[model samples]
Target chain A: MDLILTPNITDPDGFYARLIAAHDGLSDEESAALNARLILVLANQIGNAAVLEQALALAQVGK
Target chain B: MLNDRYSLAFKLYPYERSSDQDAAQPVRHPVVIVGGGPIGIATALDLGQQGIPVLVLDDHEGIGMGSRAICFAKRTLEIADRYGCGRPMVEKGVVWNLGKVFHEDRQIYDFNLLPEAGHKYPAFINLQQPYFERFMVERVRELQATGTPIEIRGKNRLDAIEVRDDHVVLDIMTPEGPYRIEADWLIGCDGASSPLRGMMGLDFEGRVFQDSFLIADIRMHNDDFPTERWFWFEPTHGAGASTLLHKQPDDVWRVDFQIGWNVDRKEEMKEENIRRRLDAFLGEGLGYDIVWSSIYTFQCRRMKRFRHGRVLFAGDSAHQVSPFGARGANSGMQDVDNLGWKLGLVLKEQAPESLMDSYDTERCFAADENILNSSRSTDFITPKSKISHTFRNAVLQLAEKHAFARPLVNSGRLSLPCVYDNGPLNGEDALPEAPARTRPGAPCPDAPLADGFVLDRLGGDFVLLTIDADAPEQLDVGGIALRRVKLSVNDDATGALAERYLGGATSAVLLIRPDQHVAARWAAFDESAVRRAVGHACGKE
Candidate 1:
């Protein structure tokens, strides 16, 4: 199972706004905790281990 | 019975007047090493044993007090073994390979540094810096007694130096009076606060972490604590933020407390205050006497260039790192190992002067590697920002339950010798099928031979190590002779040599440098290729 790197989300800006709105009323630590849980949830959804590893490597690149 | 800086282990080289001090004209020596610390003395031993005349000058008469650098890594021992002084150190040192890490009051994980067998030395030995120096100094004395051209003058301090195109003229201050001497080559092993570096108007460039650690070496007989490194983060004992405990030789233990910055250093140094903290940490029942104590703030820094004209710096004189990893003295020993052969070859006119530049190149690269690892360890140990602290704690918390996060928990990554992978002196790494541990530019991994170890056969000269392979008995390339050390799998009783050297391949040929770094290797012997590698290693290519 390959990661869908292309524009897969039909409402990209709407999803990003929703992601930001999730942390709107939270403190930095609370926001960080939320992000961590969200990452785990999203990671579980993308259950393919190799694809997740590749995604991690790609995300870490050029930082 | 507290031993301070004035405490002496061996007053080996007391103040003695030399005839050269009364010479009408300043006497010129082949090589003069400043600061008779471990690095300086090791450099002298390396050069002196190679039939090179070297002089060592030190301000102090002998080893200073305290177990300053108590952790001697295997590589350092291996290098010392090459100079014929490792056995005493290992005999007198407290050897340990296990380290247990704790988060708050709970043990998160433990690590064994060397899990496998067949290596000559242990993972690490906790010997006091004074003992380490004494062993090397004893070796120096033995060499001198055997008529090796090595002279050590205690109380002879280097006051000033004049650097020229080919030589260095140094003015000395002694208990008697002032004297002058010149050197064809000068080495600055003067340590972290290098007087020679200051005399040359040079300074290190890097980060200074805003934290201080207090090291207390106490003589205590405690049956509860095993001979292993035990570290605690956010220790529940009402001590400092973090604490370290290790066993040394002679019923001594070194305890380090990570006292935060912006505190009165003098107040912290007071014995009553120190004991107040220690008593809280160790509890009241334990009886112990303070052997030595010192406060240290580390900096991960290095000189811009290790080599400046005729002057060369090794050890702390060249670079410094946080003591977290034991990289400080271990890396300095490596610098001596690297520079000794290069400098020897240049002095003998066997290798080009450009080969000396590779010392700067390789060691500066190594220094940066040390600085990077130590700096990262420091950052992890003492997180600067709140987010970093949160992440650090998070990693520790997760490491308690998850194996994946255990690797991320950095409680000072132990010192390992740096591989000069991209070294300019490295030749073709043709043994792609062989073990990467024995690849070109990597330090030769020790393996058990039938009677002894593989590392014992190498060092001090070019060795053409061929395992289950055929090569010429010897090859002389550009006046440098490569002696062949032929070994077969049948000779390897434990099969470690075969596994470490050959891997999947049946045969291997490796050209090892005098420093025991693999210059190049092949699946089979090839004369021209070996010659090319030797030439390349000598900076002729």
Candidate 2:
């Protein structure tokens, strides 16, 4: 299953940025796996199908 | 009992020839503060900075142990900045703008603290409390270095306190000998079990939870965790199940585990018991030594009143909270911040002593709100009944799906600062009815100035903010020192400036106090009303 993650400006950026920054140091496969996990976790958090759809669209555009 | 661990050497003067000589000897400083802990030191520092002579008495030969309060809020930093400690604190501290909330191994929400860049200071910084104290002590020493005459009497203990209307007499037992000193004011910054508060017959009213938490400082080598705070709710640990991991300086981590109250008091804090909990979380084979470990029960309480006569209560002596929200130390520092400048003003006779009453009114409001939020958070985490457990689970489940539920579910209430709506100092004409987005009573929200520094960075004393000039000359608010800045009246800049300094505003004039709370604000400058409000707040009228 595919999942998407959307970052909000109001949410604390320090924690999220640090997490992403740490992920940058990982190997591509490791980073991809972690990203997939994060997307699933965030998608589970959002719960709304429309919001998830928007997040997925944004995720694909980034890719 | 006064061995190497607690020895003192005193210089004694030769005995006088007559009783008249002893009687004629010059009096020492009126007030002598005992304990160089943050509270004691802060009181002495504020008094000394106000040109009042003070002798700080401490038993320890040097500073205390461990990091203690590593999280410095923007408001606390602003207060420290006033005594020339803020810059050094900001310099040495690690600025963090985010925190991640986790449910066991799953990440529920991530918060970005750096929402807008215009504020002078960041949301918070992680700095060891000892170093922060050292910075404050150095500032105190610098004042003395200039021959300002503030003395820190270490290796001394308080034997007795005698309260007199004209002065507070202290019987201090030093290495030299027993001595008597007197002071016009006495402040207790002596922690939760403050002797001074007890001496004044002030009752600390609040609840102490039965559950105890063990805090362990460990050197972590985890690659997955970021250099940010992580809270794991209902972790698969012991009977009481939550874990808090916070990043500190020097690659150290402060982790807290909630253990139920039923454990044997003697054996519950043992290394074996601690290791068992650590093993449950980190799994086997992760080698790390616990630098420090201690267990403490959480208390949610505040003194009925912060002041009685010239004696004032600050920090833990005045109020306390569960460590669940990290509000305890931060709130204490805020008490010092609120009381420090006012004490300075009153000591200098610039403001009436009645202004001191606002400290009780304002700080009590802050303390109560902090306790309420922290207690609520504690209850949510440690649900007491099956119904509460179900409610909590349902909220979490809803938070996973609803954007509207995220703030409540993620416990953002803990992070939001309290506003003083019903404060005696707040005026009816002031923007009291402003929405939460544009609240008039809160500490000015941090925002970036066009000059690149944050607006909050300009704090440490009263600030005059002039958002726009529908009538610039009409902006005169008497009795309050005003600094005026003109920005676009109706534009995004107004929103940005409003959010930064006063939350949200189209055009207004704001008078910000030293503690960063909005002392008075006007939708548009009505000079006389502003002056009257300032007069009312400062007790000049």
* Winner by DockQ: 1
Model 2, residue B331: C-alpha shift (Å): 1.5
Per residue, candidate 1 scores C-alpha lDDT tens digits across B229-277 of 8888988886888999999999898999999888788999899888888
TM-score for each prediction?
Answer: 0.90, 0.78
Q: What's the CA error at residue B270 for candidate 2, in Å?
A: 2.7
Residue-level lDDT tens digits of model 2 in B1-541: 3232422222111122222114444254545665677767776776676677776766555566676667777766666766667788888887666777766556777767554554566667777777778888888878888876577766565667777765677665555566566677777777787766766667998997878788888876664557877777776544248787787776777888778777676786788877788877767777777867777887899999887777777888889887656686678777776777787667666678888898888889989888877777777677655445544565555455544445555342444556888777765435543445434456666554554443434445555566664544323343334555455534335355555434444556676666667767677767677667666666676
Clashes of 1: 0
Residue B39 CA displacement from its true place in model 2, Å: 3.0
lDDT of each: 0.87, 0.66
Model 1 C-alpha RMSD to native: 6.8
Model 2 has a DockQ score of: 0.02
Q: Give the fraction of true interface contacts kept by model 1.
A: 0.00
